[model samples]
Target: MMMVIVSYDVKTSDPDGAKRLRHIAKICQNYGVRVQNSVFECLVDTANLELLKEKLLDQIDETKDSLYFFNIGKKYHHKIEKFGSKDVIDLDGPIIF
Candidate 1:
């Protein structure tokens, strides 16, 4: 799977910027992604990477700019997953509300 690391520095750090980002993120959900700290780590087929790029571009206007995609997998290969007590789920079946 191709992992896409996208970073963008917005001209407007207002809600507009965040809104656009969230919109794009919604589209990216079609593939597979984990958005953290303004970086979208997308796991997808190598062939679909371009498709993901296109979707991101569609969300952005001609105004934003450092918008870069760093293809990682060869560079860094390790990342940790953290959990919290309140976020834990039972291994059995249904979850209590």
Candidate 2:
């Protein structure tokens, strides 16, 4: 499968920038994308990556902000490595004393 990682870096203040970022992230998520911080990563098996790029570009326009995205071109060799990583805390386990 083909995996994509897009690191977005836009020049704007925290609040406005973050708001736009969140809006774009939502668009990506709506397209079945897996996001991490400003990075949007997802795995798919297709002859090309056009669909993915299109979704991201739409997000850029949706937020009325500039954005950057590209395919990291890393392949998911196996299922054990996991698909994507995020900043979420591990809520499945118990806390230690």
Candidate number with greatest lDDT: 1
- The number of residue pairs in model 2 that clash at the backbone is 0
lDDT of 2 at 13: 63
Task: Mark the regions of model 2 whose C-alpha exceeds 4 Å error after superposition.
Answer: 14-18, 31-35, 46-48, 61-74, 78-97
Model 2: per-residue lDDT, tens digit, 56-96? 56555344466555554454333223445544322223535
Top TM-score hit: 1
Please give each candidate's TM-score: 0.57, 0.47
Q: Give the TM-score of candidate 2.
A: 0.47
Residues 1-97 of candidate 1 have per-residue lDDT tens digits of: 6556776555457888778867766765665544554556666666788887887787786576436787765333454243554332222237355
- The C-alpha stretches of model 1 lying farther than 4 A from their native spots are 11-18, 74-97
